[model samples]
Target chain A: MSNEQRPVWHKRVTEAISADELAEREALWVPLTEEVRELVSTAILSEVDEHAVALARQHIRAAQEILGTKVDTGSFGMHVNDEGLAWNWGNAATGQKNAVAPPLCQVPIADGVRYEADFGAGYEGPPGCLHGGWIALILDHASGRAAHLEGNGPTFTGTLTIRYLQPTRLGPAVAHAWVETRTANKFVVRCTLSTEDGVTAESEGVFVLARWARKPQED
Target chain B: MSNEQRPVWHKRVTEAISADELAEREALWVPLTEEVRELVSTAILSEVDEHAVALARQHIRAAQEILGTKVDTGSFGMHVNDEGLAWNWGNAATGQKNAVAPPLCQVPIADGVRYEADFGAGYEGPPGCLHGGWIALILDHASGRAAHLEGNGPTFTGTLTIRYLQPTRLGPAVAHAWVETRTANKFVVRCTLSTEDGVTAESEGVFVLARWARKPQED
Candidate 1:
């Protein structure tokens, strides 16, 4: 089926920035994001008393004040360059600038999409287990990425159905997604989340390439 | 309808701490969590040069070092007191200590359950819209909370089906969840997500109270 329906919200930004500048900016933000993520994990497990906690808060507030001096107005939507490179650095699944996003790293696969992350203290739900919500995010992202690669543009998840086989442990986990079938604008994809205990959750999703995003079909 | 099925993982921790200490600890971490979340939003919008960025990193690192000095091992699961009060500040939905969680504030309502949050850049997707995965998280958590209240114990989402009516816009949004039907242990809950754009997403889920958590029936 085709996704002839109009999207409620979508945007593409083409910025006039060089490749070198982008790389340099990424180098700066990536470390800060990682450190912020680590700080979260550390805060959860830290047994510090009142004095240390108070001092940490002071340091955090100072950092915030410095960064807040110059701010943008709204969300970081998709930004692309003339070189055919697109990046959404605020993406919740694997944004370079987002600290709350799981540490999902894309892996090269011959026919599909793969992502790996070591689920840590901040990602836990039930004791020693990955949160159910994060699982949904991972499955949706991996499947969407697979569809985006095949469709050669952006894709949104129309519907997703997930089955929880067991609780996923809070450690290294992998997600692998591949398209099962496709039409002119819609693609059906399947994804699985696995850990040391084997497959913990699996999902089937319908993703759509909006009409405006479709490439011209070669005749 | 009852869940006799054993869970993959669940635990209850009764700590040797008092109410005063708990309150003091909460006072310390809540602000830090808020600041960190705000810092993430600021970093996304900041157009700062390298000097400002470099300086901000030092402050963030200092905070991390101070917090990381005294750390515990593994995840922070459910912790309770002898007074029957429970707190899981590490929860992914609205954990007071978790910076990644949406700022969900529970509102007292006569029916079902209600939660409100102003989703910001950290929760953004599709331009100025909330991510689909987070929609899933909000719906799941709201429904689970409803079930937990009625069942008077922990509940799990067995299956959830979400229909995305439109893209939920960023900023203030509300989640309303209510139990549709129930038996001795199983509940079918329905939830709706709305922003200024009306109802954007809705869900129906099956929540089960694990057998081990159920209380004895009256004679």
Candidate 2:
């Protein structure tokens, strides 16, 4: 299918689902996925017997067969609305239970948003420090979410710049993002990532509203 | 422990392990971790009963208890040498079978390096498109690896800038990184991420040699 003709979820769809319902569903899925995520970490680090691995694979395959193929189609499945509800449970950065997600919790603040998460051994990069890429992932998600909240529409990251100030330790980390400026459909968002010790990284991102959402005058 | 007093892995240690041995170990670890990774993705997407979930958790806990904790240390575990043999199989970005790792295989070429990997559903951000943050993860890794290969030692990412030209589809992808310029301990590197269709995103990164690696003259 052509780019324009492809099945895409528009920004307006955010209104179709009630925030309370989405939040409730997310609550249910998050813990289930979190269990699976912990399972992954354990499987990777643990030295399980071949018999256990075999049995686990059998169970996994059975589950897969039962679930079949169901795909999520939308703003890359990471859309966050004004209510601070995002239906991106399958996303790697913020999806609850997604093995790859840091599973950040979005907290609405006065002017912007804050993400709370903890990185464990699964996210290690340097000794006790959080992996730099994972750091980028968190900032990228927070920035995009910030843009979506401020822009009131679907947006995609155009450019992201991150500077590693110091080693961010694994465990509880906080990331905050706010819209620095907006002109037409473009948003300039800035973010800071920190741990108990202090700021570990900072980032700036330019997010452009999806093509379909852009006003003719802006184009 | 104080940051300065912590037992950080010195860049000089890359010389401690032979390149051939590291390569061999990575070759072995990659497939094993790949299995664990597939298990994770499968578990997340699978449909299982509460009993299955409970059973899976039990099995996972048993494994964790049996294995105990063994943390990897040194170079923050992302070290790659001049020859491009990085002992970073435990890293989140490129570690084999690491659910977090895209598990890129670095191929040394004349004047640059190429990374090859497949991003599956676990890394998805927009429907079939690879997660943008994961995109950043791959670029950040390739750029840092490029700097390490060219600069003759370990380097950390100082700044990374990425532009998403289009939605990068999930599946086999190729990323290439080359050094653009250098000044003292700072090296500028450029990277491009693409699938069979063509270039999806491009990045430029500034990498600075770690503090302990810098010489008095370079400082």
Candidate 3:
């Protein structure tokens, strides 16, 4: 359809979801994802030479405070098309520091529940090895997003499983996710990370309602 | 025991575990954990200024590469007497940064297996939040560690699950981790990241093989 011919609510649909709405929506936060990509890119490009790395880190900290800091994966954005297509480009495993954002990639296999991406630079840890926490972050986001895609009610991780099969070296890395099971609002998602050699890590998570966080709103 | 009265092996134990030994002991790099504690403390104290953070990170990366790294229970060294009694004082999470040698830290309990730690100006990310990758580093380690404590076989994480619950603000945030299940060599570990109000992100992981790396002559 021509841009002008689109439905009026199309504007609302495309319009950025409010932060609250983003949080309330199950695994959907595309607007915030764009903002984060920009934020991280700016932080990366503005580093001072004397302490480029430190400067980049400071920027990350500031972003976390506003965005809400945690151990691994943090708040990212998502998108759901009218065609039921969903894209999650934020909450990247790496590349949150560069001018070019890491691709929020997806795969058609696994019933559109699997995905992967590669991010780099200021995010490095243990020399060439990817930071352990970063691995967890990506797995969490991928699996959680997978669970959300499984048509389950809002779910939060109640349990998690991880296995570091090998030392994940830096540079290009691959990730994959898939839904394993669903009962009621709970969805089980499984995923893995791999290097050129083979699988480096694998994970699974159980997403459930925060129940208390899901209280009915006042009229 | 007095220094002179201590056993020769005890003195060797007190001495830092060599990088070679660390690599050879893949089943449980307990020696490497000790070294990491020292290394983290050294890196933190070597320079408190923002410029020195990179240097600290470099040292940590170097040690991790040579000696390998291990997940934690927020505590590092446990002084065990011949009687099986243990007193853990080398915990990175609770120890002083300057005295701790390596910068290893125990992520305070945020909820379950979720946790948060600020690299601070000493450890910067894009601008404010912890480096996204660093977040993963901690989470992966924690997930694997939780799995180890929960099951049999020298547990290594076969998989990890995480969700960027929020941006993971840089300041004082919290992380949580817990075990979901244990079946044979497979153990499931879960984690979460949160700011002051409540849980912002969550993670889940599975650890398997128990001593996958531990073979008679592999190392």
Candidate 4:
């Protein structure tokens, strides 16, 4: 669909999020997302007693009903369209409190975005290694963020290439991304994943600026 | 660590899982996992009332305590060593009931492995598109599975390259992988992601047989 004809949600990009709002939203949601991640991890790893399971189920059901009554039974709208919210907060790679997130925190650097994370048992692939897919997720997020910093409007990933140099141990790790090159509507970003030991993975991604949302001058 | 000296858990592999056992385990866990995923998705999207939040917290605490008292607290052991259970069940990409999972079901074709899945709201990225990271995750899993089917004992992803041909919509999609080439200890696998429309993404991965766990003859 043409950008002009697209839904309001599609037009709602990071440009709509202010720095102050991003910080505030991150502050409010980060802790909650972390708690949820903890809950998910514990729930999966913990061997629950029958009584506890029953109690938990009851509580969840009650919460669902109460929330259902009080809140509109509507789709959790597109992340971008959510007013004053950081889309990354609900993301699976870097969302702070999202249950599905590895719960990485993104820190801005001079060149691009950097992330610090600990891939817990919940994201294991090999015996004691982090899942390769999760590695890609982190790189993809970081690279996209880097591309965004290039001062272009929202962009979509066109291609991503990842090299797993070694097994990423399941624990604290670091990732960094920076814009490598930029053309008319494409940004090539490079990212790396490392640990105290050394680099574990590296990635390069091509992010294409949405054709419909392209800058007027570029057109 | 050398294979012989490595921990027992490291030695555990899918080959050890019998077909009957895998089936029984899948039957037992798939539904439960799906329930958990639903709970996770709902928890994130639902807006809670103050009273409901308090009640939910209390119930969660009680359940945690009860489960804590009745169950031994320890890290969930390595998946491969978890008897006949499929580790993929709780995985974020291909897991059946994981909220983060696209829940791609892998089916064996003559040459390699194929997967069919639907990218739900939980995995959305660019407006109506599937997250680029998710596409990478699916490709990684499929390629690795292809490497495994090549009669190799076990493999680790050495590198993965993905090209997105078009936006993968948030609905039913398909993926396939096959061993493109094999060397002494490495298998090059190629994979593709597609919808009814056409190919959306393609990937090439270099899977290296784990150093410590090479087949005797190959070694």
lDDT (tens digit, per residue) of candidate 1 on B70-174: 976666777799977788787777888888887678998989999999787788767767888888888888988999998887787787777778878777889
Q: Score chain A of each prediction against the true chain A by TM-score and list the results.
A: 0.91, 0.76, 0.54, 0.77
Rank ordering of all candidates by TM-score, starting from the highest = 1, 4, 2, 3
How does residue B191 of candidate 3 score in lDDT?
A: 69
Q: Write the per-residue lDDT of candidate 4 for residues A84-104, one digit (tens) a residue.
A: 444533344544434676766
lDDT for model 2: 0.71
What are the runs in model 2 whose C-alpha is more than 4 Å off?
A1-28, A43-86, A214-219, B1-32, B48-62, B69-86
Residue-wise lDDT of candidate 3 within B1-219, one digit each (tens)? 133321121111132445454334322323323333222212211213333333333433332222222222111223344443332232223222111112345544543344445333222332334434435556665666566455432355555555655444444555556778766566667766565536655656666653544344532
Off by over 4 Å in 1: A1-12, A215-219, B1-12, B215-219
**Between candidates 1 and 2, the TM-score winner:** 1
* Candidate 4: tens digits of C-alpha lDDT, residues B49-158: 45565565554454345434543222233455335444544455565424456577887678788998855445545655666888898899889988887845568898
- List each candidate's DockQ score: 0.43, 0.32, 0.07, 0.35
Give the candidate number with the greatest lDDT.
1
Clashing pairs in 4: A33-A97, A33-A98, A34-A97
Docking class of 3: incorrect
lDDT of 3: 0.43
Tens-place lDDT per residue, model 3, A12-92, is 123344555544442222333333333322222221222333333344333333323122122123335554544332222
| lDDT of residue A17 for candidate 3 | 46
What lDDT score goes with residue A111 in model 2? 77
Relative to the true structure, candidate 1 reaches a TM of 0.91
